[model samples]
Target chain A: MTVNVSVTVNGMRHEISGVEPRLLLSDFLRDTLGLTGTHVGCEHGVCGACTVLMDGHSVRSCLTLAVQANGSEITTVEGLGTPETLNVLQTQFREHHGLQCGFCTPGMLMTGEDLLRKYPLATDEEIREGLSGNLCRCTGYQNIVAAIRSAAALRRENA
Target chain B: MKPARFEYVAPASVDAAVETLLAANGEGKLLAGGQSLLPLLNFRMARPAVLVDLNGIKELSFIELRGESVVIGALTRHREIEHSPLIASRLPVMSAAMRHVAHLAIRNRGTIGGSLSHADPAAELPMMAMFYAARLTVQGPAGRRTIAAKDFFVDALTNCLEPEEIVVEIEFPIPQHDGWVFEEVARRFGDFALASIAVSIRRGQSGIEDARVAAMGVADTPLRLEDVERRLCEIEIDVRMPDRFCEWVRSSVSPNSDLHASGEYRKHLLGELARRALKTALAAKGDRR
Candidate 1:
């Protein structure tokens, strides 16, 4: 049966009707809303490629049903920054060459945003642990760790 | 992968949820957090005709101390337990095990009740629940009833709850032990443990007064090593105690081989992890003294 889903995405409210109860949040974001920046990898949720912010907390979109997010506020990769101006974490990712294929970049950026906002992230080990759910095979996670570490330092400096 | 088409209902109260499940006639699956259930749905391993969404039941999401017990609502998320100052101060072993649960993203949306209900043999929460001797309260069409953790888990990925029943909350008695430790070895930091151990010890004037030992990923279900606990209390605390306990633990469980690790390897891990956990708990007790 189709269900009505109303959600606020990146501060913009979208009311979608006739959404299948089985539609995943990942598909809803990508196909329905045209926010393809949120990548879907390993739809079983082992890969963090579908990570997004649900009410300021990072959650696996693939594991979340679209109907489940009816009243929630979601933040996808598209919400982070634009081509003209990148957010701090996005800038650090670009500088450190965090993405080799860019398939896992969106998930990494979203998870990084969640970590930078909440954690002290004083150590590289902490950043690595925070990024454990999101896998990156191309760079072997060295540059991703570097980028997040840099962003964490910048956050500390600004605070 | 996507789930098969199913009807969805968001019930606002426990009564409503129970009623929905009853009306579905065992075809309804309770959805909490959606961390474990969603994965099952995505794989189409579980095809329930009705998905009863319990997230709207705000009353089921809570962590509070009532009387001598720390009662945690079934809907309480792992991340909430991880960051709770109350859990840190009271059930410190649980606080420590939270890190070994899934990654931060999964933990944020995963509920303790869902984890316990999922009853994954390798998952950390089931092991913790057994370690704490938690009691689960389940509500059905008949009414609410309580089940001890030992009796609650029937098998891997299975609980004793009837299809129409839902776990309302888990009540853990505040431990009065002198020391506690949770040790796990996962291939990756956030992966399911190969074999993990949890130990809690209470010291008396003479020696170890009481000991609680449990292990995961080594059997059909999370196991409480009563024989090992008895042996631990019988032996004197020394450097060799871990070695002795390791041998006891190795002999206690017959783990099955899987792609992650062999049964023999898991047995070895159970031994070593038990040794390390026991030693750490003893040392913590020593420091307290």
Candidate 2:
């Protein structure tokens, strides 16, 4: 059966029609909407490559059904600041060398964005806990944590 | 990991959800936060004909202390429960267990009712409910009813919940004895626990007054050691007695071997962790005043 779900992605409302019951949010964003920035790795919810923001909260899009997300606001990696005006987190990630293969970058960015908004003054340990779900095997989490800490510091200075 | 095609129903009320389930002829699955069910769908472990998304029903997402018992709505997410001050005061063990759930992102999307209904032998909240004798409230077309934790969990990945019914809320009694201890062995930080135990005991002047010991990942479902609790009540709280209690715990549990840990190792750790937890709980009991 086909279902129509109105999803607001990256500050734009796209009334997607004829969405399949089995269409995962990750597939919906990448295939239907052509938002290829959200990669799909380890579709089993482990690798965190399919992570995105549903109502401003980070969730595994691979596990979420497209129909269930009707009328909900979604924020993918594309929603964050662009290359010309990079968000503090994106800049810090680049500076700290947080990505090698960049397979897990989008998930890490969305999770970091949510964590910084929720916990602007998060400690190093809290930051580690915040990013626990987003796995970065390439960096061994050292540079990822550094990036989040740096972004948090910049956010604090701006605030 | 696309899920199989299924009909989706966004029910607006609990009663409406029950109606939807009844209409599906028990071939529907209630989607609360979808932390566990979503994964099951992706893996094709569960393929219900209908998916009743309960996110629209806001009534089932509350956490409030109603008198002596702390009542938590079925849709309450793990993160909210972990951060709730009411649960912190009434049921600290649940808060403690919530900390060890999947992870921050998973916890943010996982609901308590969903976890209990999933009934994984390794999950912490089921063992916590068993240890505390929490009551589960179920709602259906007929009416609302409550079931004890011991009676709620029937088997691995199963509950006593009727197919047409939904768990509306869970009530955990605030223990007069605040002394509590939780210990678990997990391969990774956020992975399923290999063996876990939740122990709580109250001490009188002469001996152990009231005690509860519950273990998970050692059986098909979480096992509440009622016989062991009775045996423990007979002994006086001391450093050496815990080792003896450990022996009783070992004899009482019938653990099964799995890839996570062998049955022998689980039994051994059960004794060790139970002993340490009992000692720690007893010590914490003395310091409560």
Candidate 3:
């Protein structure tokens, strides 16, 4: 059956109709909306590659049905700053070499953003703990943790 | 892997949700947090014909106090419970266990009622609920009924709930235990527990007033340490008292051998965990929550 959904995506409201009831929010963002920044690595929820913001809280878009996201606010990795003007987290990721193959970069950035905004990430262990949900095959989590550490410091100074 | 094609409805009210569940009969699944159910659906492990979403039922998203019990709605998310001041003040053991349920994202969408109803053998909340003397309220076409935590869970991924019954609320009795402790050992952070111990102790001026213990992951269902609890309550607690009860705790549980851990190993771990948790609880007498 078709499920109609209207979601405010990345600040822009998209009134889309005829979505399948089983269509994952990640698939909708990638295939339907052509905003492919949200990756679907495991399809299952184990890998955090599908992380996105639902009402400003990070949720697994792959596990979330598009119909369930109806009338909700969603923020994918694309919602952050563009390549020319990278967001602070994105810039820190680049500076710390947080990506080798980059399959998990989007999820890492999204989770890092949520952690920076909501938590007092004071130590490397705390940043690593905040990032436990997201999985990175490359970089061994050391660089990703380093990037989040840098972003947390920058966030503090700017605050 | 994608979920099977199914009709989805988000009922705006609890009564409507219960009605929808009745209409779908045994083929309906209630979607509360969607953290666990969605994974099961995607793997095709659960193929419900219809999903009755409870997200729109705002009334099922509250945490309130009634007398000495904390009444939590069916849709109360784990993240909310973990950070709730009421839960922190009243049932800190459950709150402490919520951190080990999953990471932030999973906990953000996972619900207490959903987790308890899902009834995974390795989950934290179910065992903690049993240890804390909680009750689960379920509403069906017939009417609403409350089930004690001891009788609610039946087996792994199964409960005593009827097919058409929707779990509406969980009432956790705020026991004035002097100290409480929930310690779990997972393969990795946020993974299901291999074997965990939850302990609650109340010490009077003379001796140990009361004690409760429960375990998870080692058995097909969450288990209460009736023998261990009884043995411990009979004696005056000391630093050496908890370690002496280790043998009773190990013998009381019948753990099954699995790929992750052997039954013998689980027994050994449970004994150690019991000793540690008991000692910690005894040491932190009259601790908050």
Model 3 C-alpha lDDT per residue in residues B157-201, reported as the tens digit of each score: 889988888888999888787688888888877889999888887
lDDT of 2 by residue, B1-289 (tens): 3687789888899999999999999789999878877778888888999999998888999988788888889999887887888877777777777767887678778888999998998998888889888999999888999999999989998999888889999998888775788788777666788888888777889888888889988998899999998988897666688898889889988788887789999999988988888778877752211
TM-score of candidate 2 on Cα atoms, chains taken together: 0.92
Candidate achieving the largest TM-score: 1
Ranking by TM-score: 1, 3, 2
Candidate 2 or 3, higher DockQ? 3
Better of 1 and 3 by TM-score: 1
Q: How accurate is candidate 1 locally (lDDT)?
A: 0.90
Q: What TM-score does chain A of each model score against the native chain A?
A: 0.98, 0.95, 0.97
Residue B248 lDDT, candidate 3, scale 0-100: 85
Q: Which of 1 and 3 is ahead in DockQ?
A: 1
Residue runs of model 1 more than 4 Å from their true location after superposition: B285-289
Q: What's the C-alpha lDDT at position A87 in model 1? A: 90
Candidate 2 deviant stretches above 4 angstroms = A117-129, A152-159, B285-289
- Residues B1-289 of candidate 1 have per-residue lDDT tens digits of 3898888999999999999999999899999989888988999999999999999999999999998889999999999998998988788888888988899999999999999999999998898889889999999989999999999999988899988899999999887888888888899998999999888899877668898888999987898888888887887777888899889989999999989999999999888887887788877752210
Clashes of each: 0, 0, 1
